[model samples]
Target: MTTATTASDDVRLSAREAAERHLRALVGRDDAVLREDQWAAIEALAVDRRRALVVQRTGWGKSAVYFVATKLLREGGAGPTVIVSPLLALMRNQIAAAERAGIRAVTINSTNIDQWQPIHDQIHAGEVDVLLVSPERLNNPGFRDEVLPRLAATCGLLVVDEAHCISDWGHDFRPDYRRLRTLLAELPTGIPVLATTATANQRVTDDVAEQLGVHADGTSDAAVLVQRGTLDRESLRLGVVQLKTPEQRLAWLADHLAEQPGSGIVYCLTVAATQEVAGYLRDRGLEVAAYSGQTEADERHALEQALVEGRVKALVATSALGMGFDATLGFVINLGAPSSPVAYYQQVGRAGRGTDDATVVLLPQAEDRDIWAYFASLGFPREEQVRETLAALAESDRPLSTATLETRVELGRNRLESMLKVLDVDGAVQRVQGGWVSTGRPWTYDAERYARVAEAREREQQAMLGYLRTTECRMRYLREQLDDVGPDGRAADCGRCDNCGGVTLSSAVSDASVAEAGQRLSRPGVVLEPRRMWPTALGNLGLDLKGKIAAGAGPGRTVARLTDLGHGQALRQLFREDTPDGPVPPGLAQAVMDVMKDWSSQWSSRPDAIVVVESATRPTLVNDLAEGLSRVMQVPVVGTWAIRDPSVPPRAGASNSAQRVAAVRRRGGLDADVPPGATVLLVDDQVATGWTLTVAAVAIREAGAGAVLPLALATQG
Candidate 1:
């Protein structure tokens, strides 16, 4: 609540006027004026040289505050502004906006690694006024060791975009963002800093503001300005559609997507669902494209442009398209519910940015909780795994790369890397040139804190479910979830939601459309690409495997991915621990046969024999699959590989590739003799890491099989 002491009244007013002029230039409108709070924020940063956090709605001109402050500060002889952004899409949009305002802006991100050196040169040469870098770049060994120190010392203003990610309590917490505390500690005392986010609740807001208030000497100033506005989006009309099945949901979209006012986004919970929904919509003669983290960078850019320019009807996407993607999208439809209401609010905020009224609808399906549970399994690892990682790092004479560390720990590559980032931020480890090194600093496990976070996440999930069935005002519920307190200390109801008697979406869908959707979804198969190379550093695990693997298995086929919209439901039910072991059901049997009928045509040679990978959990299902395929394809059942040991507990899962491979090699071997150079069919009930199939195929090939055409009932996409 303290004002900047250095700026007098007249000087602050003059700076405020200059900021408005900059805003007018940026928006290309002479009449454009800064909102009261925006001016207050810019005044604090530009004139007062103090830290501030702006928690405003998505379209409330938070970017304008920073851009204007950057311009005014640079004019007063401050150095270039360093903005730590989260997404490439956001960086692109900011660069474009900076150009429109005649401010020189450049970016350093994964997509433009070749341009980073020149960008750094421009910043050093005083030619660039603004620099945008991803938070992940803050931990890069070269950047952290070489460029970041200079940037921190010389940057005029530090802007943290999407700052909610810096808080572990936030819905979309990122480990790399924890590095911000280190960066903050390096900044000079009087250098201005601005952190902006549209999605932070009270807890996230307080967390970020506390970090912002820290000084170079490790003391908190308590003078950081926190300006939080209402979280309501006036142009969004919210509603929900409760559907019984995935087929009916797709039918609803197929029936109603084109009817939306303008081009928009259709969101799904999983990548496989994105592809499935986009493909089905396109087959229904709608113009759309599937977008996710798995999409190529070039294609993502093209698809984004298509949506912005109204070239495509919509982009069926996952959370990949969530933060800071700017478009005048007229509608946003969710194929499934997100696990957290805060995250849901952020995604839906992408729409109605430039429109009078945007359609926002949630189509909640029956399988959403299952998807939530699957994602929950990927949260923070157990304490033993973290201890093991630290122990390995402490024992190594030299820094071990993530791949090398993976060979020592039982964690997967992604999860292990994430845990290391958090530890680095906590002073338990440090990232050096080659890899990570133990800092020898004492650190607590913080089991109670982790438990509290888990409890919070559970509450958020249950609240999201309640959202689907709530009778109160939908918009008010969302705002309250974000802790948005208005001037009256309460979130008021918007008269536009379905529960509030606004424009209600039709619940009726054509019988023909539903039938078509069901038929299309029932047709299930996913092409499984074969692993061409073995995981690195297998020698550490007493295996000689490395380098490009010899071709033991060709491309394979699975009935469906567990994330798919069609037979995925059935597969999920069948794989549940409570589900009893039995033969393959009639519907799934037909699906497997159908997959075989289509997949066999793509093979170079038909299989002469079938080999089953024994499943300890579902032996009957795997045996029945092998026998049925043997009868149908006229291929003999030649062998069985007991990869799943009964004595070894499955409590600790094998998500890591090297771990799975080592376990399979220990217990798996072909038992039946094979004809030399004869084609073989490998059957399994499910393919998770795919190591069982790969290892089994290698052993079968060593047994003199010509080619392995592996088939599975489902895949864990």
Candidate 2:
């Protein structure tokens, strides 16, 4: 194939026929034929060998185009196609789909580490027709320096699935996806490239198309073919159910989940919520399972299989189950709304892929905004943090691991790592074997660009809220958010949606169901796991602490996590920044008493004394909690800690292990006199880092306490 290849008499007819054959084989239906748009994309990639961007709705045969193109290219004696997929779930589904077409596809991802070398060998030996890799793999040191160069030179076609992630303007922007620009630029001339996404607004579409045409040498390439299609999904019936409380929402789900058409997903905003919701639903006799990023790889696979086979009613999940999770889900219920419409569209798109009339419902609660804000806060850190990180790497003679870097900087591990990835893509840093090292290249923080992105995020959030309140066609509003107008470029209604069809989900949930939900949520206690080992590389921070912690506080219990469904909702109100610090509330105190009552049954020994940790914030709450526990347990409030350096307050969740430990140590010592070998109950209003409680427990133990049993009103874990 040459760069000038395009629609021609001989090439057009031959490519179209081959694409149809591949399409039919993949779909397992003799009647399967390429849509006009699908054929256009395949013609561009296979017949013309030109870069193309296909922006279509979910279930619009985007994958068919790429797979058929890969087949046609390989049949023409081209090299194996290389696809950069965003999620392992997507890669897994793609691999299976390619098999249906008799394409010898192989994948390299974070999972299946032991098979990497063999997979690479298969590609080299021409035994593989397609290679699917996560975008993160593209920038990996070994893969980037070795494997990528070879793949770029020899790959017949380059495909980017979920391509919207490459644009910062995209709802689910991923820093790693930006690395595709390098891959695109390095590919030999005349190699065809295809970028596909089901959820990109016009802004994201244009941004991706521009990037697709850019070469590595900061120059533009030939025009890229852009295939845009309608975003409406006929199978989806969109509706929003406004609920007042978490209990009400849970009650609605419990009452109506079984009424939905088929097995589907119940999307929650947090991992903790998924567990809580799934457990509640299971108790109500629903065959549901909780899934999140924390779920083990093997278990996630099993859960996914169960969902696919209709063995479970639904999976209460976070966005971990989003993006390319293929199932003919009959319905999708959101326990909470996504922060933006684009993300919301992508998620709900998972439903109704292979079935008609899939129910898409959104249950929006007041706390959804609060959840959105919490996630929004995790965006790009302040300029000072970037400077500190760069300085740390620049000053080091050798590569410093993230743990060591954490000692010098205060950002949390996840945030730190995310920043490093962005910096690496920007040429300010490079990931070496040890960890990360600063490149000598000059870099500047693009405050203006970041500000614009933030503003866009805010607008999207507001639009999501508007969607909930709009009386117009729900599908139309969502499509408009994605800049998807019909062929006429005019707004049109999807006649099947709840709004357009005048269909409403019954808002009435039985009071008994609500009460039961409240009861389940109200019964709160979460295991407070004790730290078994000191954080890695604590010595770098001048702390003597290292390795296993010596006989530290035993496992304890907390009333609830600040993110839990039941008492957690109430705790959030109590801990809001604007909320005045005061004595513990009646409900929280009752929950704490309940937890203590249940915990004492399993304790090896009963506590004889209670100790409260000093809290610069919520001191009154801590003292009150300690006093109440002391009164209930018939123990004395024997001791409390003092703040030695009030000027330097504890930075709760901002610090890493070393910084947290050091901060806690800087606080004044406990002043209690404990009888030798006496058990002590450690009390605190909340356990954020858990370091504060740990440091206090150590002090109590040194003061003659035999064992420390930590208890808190809530945990932030």
- Candidate with best lDDT: 1
Once fitted onto the true fold, the runs of candidate 2 whose alpha carbons sit more than 4 angstroms away are: 486-490
Each candidate structure's TM-score, on Cα atoms with residue i matched to residue i, is 0.98, 0.98
Candidate 2: what lDDT? 0.88
TM-score of 2: 0.98
Worst 10 residues of 1 by lDDT: 644-653
Error of 1 at 673 (Å): 1.4
The residue pairs in collision within model 1 are: none
- Model 2 / residue 206 / CA error / Å: 1.5
Backbone collisions counted per model: 0, 1
- Write the residue-wise lDDT of candidate 1 on 140-241 in tens digits: 989988998999889999999999999889988999998888888788767888999999889889999998877667788688999999899989999998
RMSD of each: 1.5, 1.6
lDDT, model 1: 0.89
